[model samples]
Target: MPSRSGPSDAPRWCVLGRVPGGGVARGRVAAVEVDAAGERSAPIPIATAELPAFVAARERSAPRWVWSDTPSWYPRLLEAGVRIERCHDLRLCHAILSRSEAVPDRGPLLAAARWEAGPGAGEGEPAESALFEIETPEDAPGAVPHDLDAALEEFDRQRAALAACVDPGRLGLLVAAESAGALVAAEMAAAGVPWDAAEHDRLLSAALGPRPARGAKPVRLLELAEEVRAALGDPRASLDSPPKLLRALRSAGIDVESTSRWELAEHEHPAIRPLLRYKKLSRLLTAKGWAWIDEWVRDGRYHPVYVPGGVVTGRWASSGGGALQLPRQLRPALRADPGWVLVSADVAQLEPRVLAAMAADGAMAAAGSGRDLYSGLVEQGIVGTRQEAKIAVLGAMYGSTTGDSGRLVPRLRRSFPAAMRLVDTAAAAGEQGGVVSTWLGRSSPRPGDEWEELQARASLPGATSRDESRARRAAREFGRFTRNFVVQGTAAEWALAWLAELRLRLARLPSPTSAESIAPARASGPAFERQPHLVFFLHDEVMVHAPEGQAAAVAAAVRESAEAAGRLLFGSAPVDFPLELRIGERALKE
Candidate 1:
């Protein structure tokens, strides 16, 4: 490994990619340098085995690591006890810049067909057979290339694209924040969320009775099943099957078309209540029951593999353990250690805040200033009440033009015309098959070929009224998706910024003393044992497990990070991102 430190003023980047044939898990590292005179040097290749030491020595210089995908590379480095402070994830950034409206020159990126491939199988999965697998004939257009040469080429193209962006600074910030988010995702999975198996078991037992024997139902579930069967007047009816349940309901004159809970609740059937209860309990038993606990929870920690940039809108998706869809009933199992407290903080009205900022809607921003945004709307006479304000705002963003939401949206349009115009314009774009983008340049995917074909057929010389109507409905459906995509996607970017800043702040805090260490902290691994660290993150919420003595500090860091994220995204805009912070032994109930 090379050890000489470079001058502080120079910029350096290490690009890592898989080597052709190395049985010992070897790869290639290219050291790229840029001097103060704007002079660039050719990439110097180093053997893969020397990476850890080289990276460790370069840590002090803090050069950014540019790689094909963060997940593929970072986890291995982390296991080697190496941590990278900064990176430019070529795959993630390529997804953003290729379609970003801000990018003035996307031709090179758009033509890089191999750079558009979906992420590798998520963390912990088997590695793909080939690193730079050539795009197949059936592969999607613009699939990202995976080898060293392709990574370097894509990185160069992405940099050029950023340089050609309308707001290069903001777009650059977005890419950096996105890469930081990838690091956070990997670290969170590595540390795992502290979970209490016993508490989960107790909650399950209380809710659905003791775990049943091999093939039998639990006491409460069995009781509910019997009650449902009796009320339906069909002892032989299989409550477990949706088709059977629906048939039973109809035979009993329930007049419901489906066994869905909402439709069933609307009816006055004698069996509806118990059937709903039974379904809820059944869901709990199957999704997060004893089997789930035994498989996911280990050493008092629940590790979930997080896939960053997994969704088209740039939101993360979990591969396993239902990390993103953790049911509220099971939240109590998110227990902190004996000497630790969980700083669970979630922003209120995140999308609306992002919309206000992005649209530069001063009145809307003023309404949400330093208070509950919905209540602020109510106080400003934008709507009669907080509930109405919420409905209208959601309806506008979601492109609802009927029902209560639709009726209420016009009122919001009158009050917050700028904010309404922002989403309405996005909706219009989608309706016309045009692309839309988030505040930070994450572009919504282009309409599919089938969607394009539908519109084309509807516009033909002899198109039927039915064809036109179907096209119109499909366009409107897509419009609603685009309308929400901008706000939701931007909100996700803001969240990534928040997490990145908070992670850095938490790292700066003092590590817990040995005396303060607990089982959960120990199980969290070397990177996060003592210091305040983020353990769990949902869209707008994050729970940090911290030492009890540092709870106040962690709370402050959370708030500070929120503010920092707002500033990073919107500069000095008046829009506020206020978090509903709760520092407690466990996550608080809403």
Candidate 2:
């Protein structure tokens, strides 16, 4: 997200932190200006109430604001109608560099472990000083320090580690993209996805036979449960309990190993069909039933907490509201504002394309350059059918070594040796208890001590066969994890880059005028009131809420940014990341 400093206007690095007592009724906030070379000026203290105005004034000369944490700072600025272009989030960068393999030595970063802790590390959050406070939960214990001294020190440490890394350019890009993601997360939370509460209720009612009163089950769910119990020939079966249901199935002569849909599908019993349907509806009722609508949707919007980099693969996770678990059946509730539309887009086979580029497999790249990669493979005789190609590619990346996937993988390796080699090498390293990193340098965690000890015991002269078997099994399981980690992590990096670029491009577009018949989404905060902004993102997919006049422009920006992300990461590789795009009033899949 860092942009170039023009010839006349140089970009300054402004470090923001709390001055002691800044939270008092009439206290001051502290800030210091540091140039790119790390030269700092004298502290400039401003009144807490006037801090937003000061920040707005300083926006004329673009500044990369350095702060301890984005969530701890950016939300308040957003509330004050101030939007920053970019930032260096010390807490996020510290977490990245401390475990990054690109940094040969992370001793200094590891010693500053407080920076790696969650928000609220040392002296409490900057929010406590009223400079960045919001109505969020209290900062967790061991919060990152929010004072000027600590901020400056952590920034210097991150900068130093980045400079000393094996590839500063790549690692730096990762850090910048990650920080941008943190900002996007905060902004998206503020903007909230446009939701139709009435439509949501209608859908839930139709699907589940109306909302139930407190401490009662939905009528439809109860009916389905009874059907399942009846089909199992056990009227007293507790369908909600997994073990009890499994026992009931055995009693009915279904002979299923578990209550999972996969195992159930292998049997032809009457109970299997109703049981699968029951489980599906049960999950929906439990996860996003009427209660969910009441709790998460408000002001005609849904604000789900997005935790960037929450997954080890650098994918996002939700802390509340089950954002990641949104059911497709409820997607129609993801309606846009009256005068706006949603631009929905997602890449086609992201991981395989990343793999091709990362490994520079020209054959694979050529196959996927301008069409469906799986279809291209099928056409090129790599596999007999598109389904086979899908199975093979997934098997290669996920270390699947049984069933149809395993049988089809060898053909892909022969056709796309370089791509297969890349993942194979990663898997081999993982099996030997070595570390593997994504294309952008986010390293995998080291094998646990238990794993190491098991491997060691297996190597002993008189080790039992059980120990050896356990060690081998553990090693293979870890290998599967590492195999997927590299591809999944790099794909995540690509998504982050795409999201950041699209965000910037959307910002450059013109906002809707009063004459355009568009209304401000005030719930989204003032910064994005009438403008096109990202409302939802899940892995490779993104949805933007934009005025009718800007829907075409927003759609184009989405495509262009995706292409830009490909070039930004892979640099002229023939690999293509195609998207399935839709623009409409509702974010419906069809």
Candidate lDDT scores, in order, read 0.82, 0.85
List model 2 lDDT by residue over 1-590, tens digit each: 33445542354688888766635533346789887666788888876667678888987687888887887777777888888778888887888899998998899889986777753244232344444433222335777766778888888888888889767989989998998998899899888889898998898888788888997988888888888888887899988888998899899998878888898899998777777887887888888887888899888889888888888899988877899889998899999888889999999999999999999999999889888999999999989999999999999999999999999999989999999999999999999998899988999988999999999999999999999999999999999999999999999999999999999999899867776537755544556657899999999899999988888999999999999999988899888899999999999886
What is the Cα-based TM-score of model 2? Answer: 0.94
Q: Each model's TM-score?
A: 0.92, 0.94
Q: Give the 10-residue window scoring lowest on summed lDDT in candidate 2.
A: 130-139
> Model 2 segments beyond 4 Å from truth?
1-11, 22-28, 118-139, 520-524
lDDT by residue (1-590, candidate 1, tens digit) is 32335564646676655444445333445565554333456766656555666677877877788777776667666655677788888988887888898998788989987777675532245344344221111112344444667776787788889888777998888899889999998888877888989999999999989888877888999899899889988998898788987888899889988889899999887798989999999999988998899889888889888878888788988887899998998898999888898999999999999999999999889988999999998898878988898998888888888998989998888888899999999999999999998888888888899999999999998999999999999999899889999999999999999999998998887776777655454553755555788889899999999888889989999999999999999999999998899988877678
How accurate locally is residue 502 in candidate 2, as Cα lDDT from 0 to 100? 95
